[model samples]
Target: MADELIFYTNPMSRGRIARWMLEETGVPYKTEIMTFGGTMKSPEYLAVNPMGKVPAVRHGKTVVTECAAICAYLADAFPEADLAPTPDERGSYYRWMFFTAGPLEAAATNKALGFETPPDKARMAGYGRFADVMNTLEHAVSTTPYVAGDRFTAADVYVGSHIGWGLGFGTIEKRQAFVDYLGRVTDRPAHKRAVAIDDEAMKIAQ
Candidate 1:
């Protein structure tokens, strides 16, 4: 059966991560762009995601919500692309993937709001704490060429996307590892293609 992909996205949201992964997978897909102020609240879109968030993917009958989940799902679903991590690497894969969604966002969000994590119980959080999270990220990215090591994997797609968006949004500083990782990931042909499409779309909108 042909894999039919319906990507529900809003240009200004986290959906961009999914978009980059889709391109990396090199699979053709249909896009359903939603607007703000009310388009997302429509009953039709809400039927797919009660949260009414963008970056949701409908592959055939399976509906995958959440950006990291969508990235893993697409890579797994399209194993021919060699983007999926091997069974041995699954643990580390999930670690960084969820780390981005869990701690990175928590730390970045808190930082954006001018709050800091208290040292006493900071490790209790999945990301440990803002500084810990940053340090952990720095270590992982600085020491490894990709998230899963020498060979690139789906985890890189998620982790790199976080780094990319973080640096772009000014939510995170342009550290060496982050700058280097973002440069490496964005250099992929698939990523370049994805950016071209998104860029054209933006130009047309303007």
Candidate 2:
């Protein structure tokens, strides 16, 4: 028998990113929809993720949290999907994945909350300046067809989700490079299916 795969998520959260990666893997898994301040904080879910966050995955006895980690794990777990990067692609794959997960996420959240790092204190911040992050991101996406170069890998799933969400929510700048890169990565059946599932889940939650 195979190990069971379970996905915990909320439609209105970053769980959508993990959902897309799961769909891309074409694996059979169970979805557990959690609501904010409710099931998410329950002891049951808390045991699975001490942070009580959605988008955690339990494969057999192994539990993985964080969207970036989940994407990487799934790609490696189901290599038949070919989402993991090749040897030469590892540099860019891990680079952009961590970049988006750390710097991009922090900068965008701070900007949306109308908080900016002081020029003098920018040196203390991991993301430095939001504008610098945006410019770097633009260069990253514009320089290659995909973040890992020439192919769509798990890195794309993680990085592209942030760009897509940022663009939709006005957290990311409206650069032509960003718009083009987003279009290129998301024009796939897996992405479409993920969106549809989450959209329906949102309606149910409402």
The lowest-lDDT stretch of 10 consecutive residues in candidate 1 is: 197-206
Instruction: Look at candidate 1 and tell me the lDDT of residue 90.
Output: 79
Q: Pick the candidate with the highest TM-score.
A: 2
Count clashing pairs, candidate 2: 0
> Per-residue lDDT of 1-206 in model 2, one digit per residue for the tens?
88999999999999999999999999999999998999999999999999988889999999999999999999999999999887776999999999999999999999999999999999999999999999999988988899988889999999999999899999999999999999999999999999999999998772
Can you give the TM-score per candidate against the true fold?
0.92, 0.98
lDDT of 1 at 128: 68
Question: How far is 203's C-alpha from truth in model 1 (Å)?
Answer: 4.4
Per-residue CA lDDT of model 1 for 93-184, tens digit only, reads 78787888888888888878988767887766666667777888888787778877777777888898888877877778778889988787
Q: What overall lDDT, based on C-alpha atoms, would model 1 receive against the true structure?
A: 0.81
Error of 2 at 10 (Å): 0.7
